[model samples]
Target: MSTFQYLLGICVAVVTFVIVIEMLRRRRLRERHAAWWLVAGALAIVVSVFPQLLDTAAGALGFDVPINLVFFVSLFVLFLVALQHSSELTELEAHNRAIVERLMVLELKLEHQLNEESQ
Candidate 1:
């Protein structure tokens, strides 16, 4: 990469890292969710600082182009994040269902008691 490209990469990576930290400090992002972002930012910084590392990795992984490897990894990370969200959503739905069922039961008992009291 040219000098300009290197500087741009480093700047972008640093900005991304800083943004993630700022979000964390402001409580906009939870620690658990930020884990992947932090890792990604760190990796980006490392790769930006040492572009050769990405080339070596791409070569080892049989990728003809280093950028292609970056794209693949990014997609993989996104897929994992989506899968994690789906799992959490399923668990939350289960909990919500249980709470709703308990609420209905409680309402029925209260209504029965009110009817008996009136009679």
Candidate 2:
């Protein structure tokens, strides 16, 4: 095996190990999410071990030049993360508005009671 291939395999292994550790620590990655990452990592490991897969995939995709698919996949994952954050922000905003409305109603009632007593 060439030194380049050996180095690629080591990098893939290290990334996969770190991902697994993070998923375990967070405990938020459901089976479906884990499955996707596992499949991606496995494919990467396989391709790194056998560099021929890169040529095959490039040919199948009709690209004369080799492209790194990982970049596209990472971008998609980042978009998903942003979407989830937006949804959470929306929910929090709605909850805060409801609380403010309730507080205003209580303040108005208290002021009316005080005025009636003074009169």
How much does each candidate deviate from the true structure in C-alpha RMSD?
0.9, 4.3
lDDT of each: 0.95, 0.73
Cα miss at 36, model 1 (Å)? Answer: 0.8
Number of the top-ranking candidate, with lDDT as the measure:
1
Q: Which lDDT tens digits does candidate 2 get at residues 1-119? A: 68986787869766995686588579967554465466667766777776777778777876675555545655776677677668878999999999999999999999999999999
In candidate 2, how many Å is residue 3 off?
Answer: 4.4
Q: Alpha carbon lDDT of residue 15, candidate 2?
A: 93
Candidate 1 lDDT over residue span 62-111, tens digit each: 99999999999899888888888899899999999999999999999999
Backbone clashes in model 1: 0
What are the models' TM-scores? 0.96, 0.55
| Candidate 1, run of 10 with poorest lDDT | 76-85
